[model samples]
Target: MSVFPIRFLTLAVIAFHSNSFAASGQEQQLFLLIRQLDTLDTLVQSTPRFEAPESNARYRFDYPRLTQDIQHIRQGVKDYLSPSRAQPRDPNELVGDYRLDAAHAEPWP
Candidate 1:
């Protein structure tokens, strides 16, 4: 029998092993991301409660909503890292627009 078959088999095994190693490294990085997300959630919670000065600006930052969105992201990541089953993806999307129309205040100058 020709040695070509044996050489091909060895190469295939090496390729498979390399792919597995790469996947393992990627998973580790994702796990680290989950930890960082936890830290971010803590920081968001610790933020002091205060109201912004009223203004006629068209839009204002919605901090509370933003915090909610962050928590949503954290949960999504956690689920991805440890899914219970192949469940359907969430239908709702992130309300990335953190700006809310300023309460009807004095008109712009």
Candidate 2:
């Protein structure tokens, strides 16, 4: 009937397809990162230099450089995998109540 309905339908289809594409891309990226992590884990396990004393290597080295590398990689992975907190909020919710002098402030939007 109306052009508005057709436009709305078109937009809905585009949104659905875009969401599917984005989701698949995210899944692929996550799988690749996990694979890389698994490979790193294997290397870490195979390294005699990275071993602990009670496992038991008589006297373990502090290995500060290796520790720093591990920390940096771990932090990078954590940051990459972490969800962003800057999400859109409901516009109706007001952030500040400073303007009490007004008869009313329409909802934040």
Candidate 3:
């Protein structure tokens, strides 16, 4: 019956909706980039190979350029998809109890 709960519920709902929208936008952007890559693959496959001098040079250049472009795109995608790393811990913090004495610890009988 308190107003605090109602306010908290409203804020929670707003945050949820905002997160959903942001996630959907990111998904759509990724989908578009994938589609673009698919189209590039199709174009690369459909192009005809040539035995002539000029065509050969162009073809050679095209492949390397295509490879570089694909690498750049893949790196971009990886950067976008990868999660952030955890923050580093302080070295001064003790992880666990390090008891040196054998008698003080529990002995296995």
What would the per-residue lDDT of candidate 2 be over residues 28-108, giving only the tens digit for each residue? 555454455445444443445423234322333323333344445444445556646644333333221222212222222
Off by over 4 Å in 3: 1-23, 51-61, 84-109
Predicted candidate 2, C-alpha RMSD: 24.8
Question: Where's the lowest-lDDT run of ten residues in candidate 1?
Answer: 1-10
Candidate order, lDDT descending:
1, 3, 2
C-alpha displacement of 71 in model 3, angstroms? Answer: 3.0
Error of 3 at 35 (Å): 2.4
TM-score of candidate 3 against the unseen true structure: 0.39
Pairs in clash, predicted candidate 2: none
Q: Residues 33-108, candidate 1, lDDT per residue (tens digit)?
A: 5565556555545554554545556765555665676567657767877899996598878776656677732222
Candidate 2 residue-wise lDDT at 59: 35
How high is each candidate's TM-score? Answer: 0.60, 0.31, 0.39
Candidate 3, residue 18: the lDDT equals: 54
**Clash pairs (backbone) in predicted model 1:** none
| Model 2 alpha-carbon drift over 4 Å, by segment | 1-23, 50-71, 87-109
